[model samples]
Target: MENEKDGELLSYSVTLNSQVVEESKELIKSTGGKLSPILNNLLKKWVEMNKVNSENKE
Candidate 1:
């Protein structure tokens, strides 16, 4: 994000382990920029699985 009014550039750095990242570059090349929805779906599945696990413990 950039602060256009102040002419300042804002950015955030996310640190990730390469081996765990699954090299999405290849997927991007194949899908041609449709990765956002796929990522959202995966995150939804992760949250559901976490909820299921917590429920089982109780």
Candidate 2:
């Protein structure tokens, strides 16, 4: 499937800490933010950081 502008999409189920999830929901609601974008940005940053670390290690 395709995303609005990010091209293809993949679905994965992840387990997160309950407390953190609750806190994140509250923060998102208070700030009028959407969860998907927040998660996407976080995962993208994590992937980039890991890639850089792996390259440096090689």
Candidate 3:
């Protein structure tokens, strides 16, 4: 169902450290992965981490 698929989408706003921003910027500049793609990747990572952590709490 659409709702199930939607649940897989990553959505968040996480504050990044200055060093992390600089590192990600460098990666984007060198790899040309585009800003949105980089951010999307980070968001997905956060979602996965949260899911794993929440599951462990059960």
Top-lDDT candidate index: 3
TM-score of each: 0.39, 0.40, 0.40
Encode model 1's per-residue lDDT on 1-58: one tens digit a residue. Answer: 3466333321111122222233444454566656698785674455556555544534
Candidate 2 lDDT, 1-58, residue by residue in tens: 2464332221111122333445555666665645578675674455556555544544
Clashes of each: 0, 0, 0
What's model 2's overall lDDT? 0.47
For each candidate, the alpha-carbon lDDT, in order, equals 0.45, 0.47, 0.53
Give the distance in Å from residue 9's predicted Cα in candidate 1 to where it truly belongs: 42
Judging by lDDT, tell me the better candidate of 1 and 2.
2
Candidate with the larger lDDT of 2 and 3? 3
Scanning candidate 2 in windows of ten residues, the lowest lDDT window is 7-16
